[model samples]
Every structure is written in structure tokens, then in C-alpha cells.
Target: MTVELMATAEHAPHREEFAALYAQVQQFYAQQMRILDADADGGEARWAATFTEDAVVELPLLPAPLRARAGLTHYARAAAERRRRAGSRLHHWVGMLDVRPRPDGTLHTRCSALAHATPPGATSKILYVCVMEDVLVRAHGTWRTAHRRITRDDLA
Candidate 1:
């Protein structure tokens, strides 16, 4: 069974909630960069922690994990390769989000996403467009992603 240690936070109000939500979103992508960048100082773990005990992630360019362990393993391999190949840098940009509170107190948030990887000698950015759907839970007065899914709109 997956652990719910990361799903404990609360939303005070609209303003406060948005503030927290925005932070979470920003952190989420930052962690992704960490995985790409290989900064293990909690980024990857925190990223995985964002999900629920039995959360799910769907990536068009990747396979869905049967569980968190599998997910982490897949990510580990993907990261190993991505870290190589001399490139300027790869970044993920998150856009306007639509966040809704579920009946069970989990937040369902969706946003337009763009993943850009710039090569060392490339003049253009390779962009990946998708809608990122996330499920966030509030536990122990903290908000973390319980689950996330990236539905690629158009692979580039």
C-alpha cells in the first residue's frame, strides 16, 4: 500500500488556498527539473510524496506505474538518460490552473503545461504541450500532490 504521509494540508480560504496551490504547482515542476537535473536532496522524494497512497500518473511518452515503487523506478531510468545528452537545459512551464475541491477534501487541479528542452547547439526549443491534472490532499495542515496525470495534447 502507498503511504499518505505527503497528503496532509489545509486550505484556509481562496487567497490563501491559491497561494498554497501555486506554491505546490511551482514545487512540483521544480522537482521534475530536479529529477532531470539529478538533485536528490529531497526533490525526487518530495515529488513522489506529492501523490496519494494509491495515486496515479499518466504520461503519453511513458508507461503508467502499477505502484509508487514502479513509478520511481521508471523515473530513475528516465532520469539517468535525460541527465546525459549535452543540452543547455530542459524546463517545464505551468500555466493558468483550474483547481476544484473534491467532496473528500482532495483538490483536483488542471493546467496547461509546456516542457521545453534546449539543445547545446539548437536555436529553437523542443516543446511538449499537455494538460496536467493533479489531485492534492490536505493532511496535517500541509498540502501536497496526491496524484498527477499529464495528458499530452500534441507531442512535439
Candidate 2:
């Protein structure tokens, strides 16, 4: 085989690996959005399931970080309640994801999302812009979030 063909063959596996990781990251965020869009019933549990058992979620709007499944579940429940109270539904549009492989065999991703809310008898309005930094690990052949820090542009 020629040198050029040999080089391409050698790089094929790495390309596929990156592609798989990218797909996993995309799927993880998609699942999160799905959970957020879901109604209150059982939504907290579904959202908590997207994280690892010991995951930590940091939200700028919260006073303290949410640690572990229980805290995450609580946050999800509270979010659902807030939505219910306002008769609002949120739509999150994710954009400009930067995914990198970490040295510790994990994936680090930075992504931005624009959130819009539609309230009763009102048109949808942009609620906030969020930039999320996340660390994801693969366990049992599936990727789960280990840590997430969400920074809101509106807070600045």
C-alpha cells in the first residue's frame, strides 16, 4: 500500500472513535432536553437518570450546587413545579458545541443553548442564554454526565 493510503487507513479508527464520542455527546444532550420538555409527571426521575449516580449539577440561578441523584431529582422537580405555576413550557435550542477528549478518559464538552418560554396566552420569549461546561464519562458502554456547570449570560 502507498504511504498516503497507509496513513489514511491508520487514521480511520481514530476518526471513527471521535465520531462515536460526538454522537454520544449529542444524544446525551438530546435526552436532557427531552426530559426538560416532558410534563411534571415522572419528569424528575427521568432527568436525574441522565446523570451518573454521583453527578453534580451547578446552576447559576441556584444558591447551592446540586449533588448526587437526590439533589438533582429535587432540582428537576422544582423546575417542573415552576413551569406548572407559570403555565409555561420551555424550548431549548443547543448550539456551538465544543467536545474534547480529557486526559482522564472522559469527555469535556462546552455548549451553548438558547431557551425560550411560552406562557399562558403569551407568545414565546427568550428566557435566557446558557453556556454549559460538562464532564461526561462512559460506563457500561454508555455515556453519562459526571459534572455540569451552567453559566447564564443573562446573569452577567
Among all candidates shown, the one with the greatest lDDT: 2
Off by over 4 Å in 2: 1-13
Best by TM-score: 2
What RMSD value applies to candidate 2? 5.5
Whole-model lDDT, model 2: 0.82
Worst 10-residue stretch by lDDT in candidate 1?
1-10
- Candidate 1 C-alpha lDDT tens digits along 1-156: 012212323333455665666676567555654564453444555555545556666677765433563475557556645645453566677766666667787777788878776677876485778888888777666665566677776754
Candidate 2 lDDT by residue in tens digits, 1-156: 445434433544586776666677788888888887888599888888878999989999788889998898887898889898988998888867767776678887888988899998899999889998999988777788899999998796
lDDT of each: 0.61, 0.82
In model 1, residue pairs whose N, Cα or C atoms come closer than 3 Å (at least 3 residues apart or on different chains), thus clashing, are 8-139, 8-142, 9-138, 9-139, 9-141, 9-142, 50-145, 51-146, 52-146
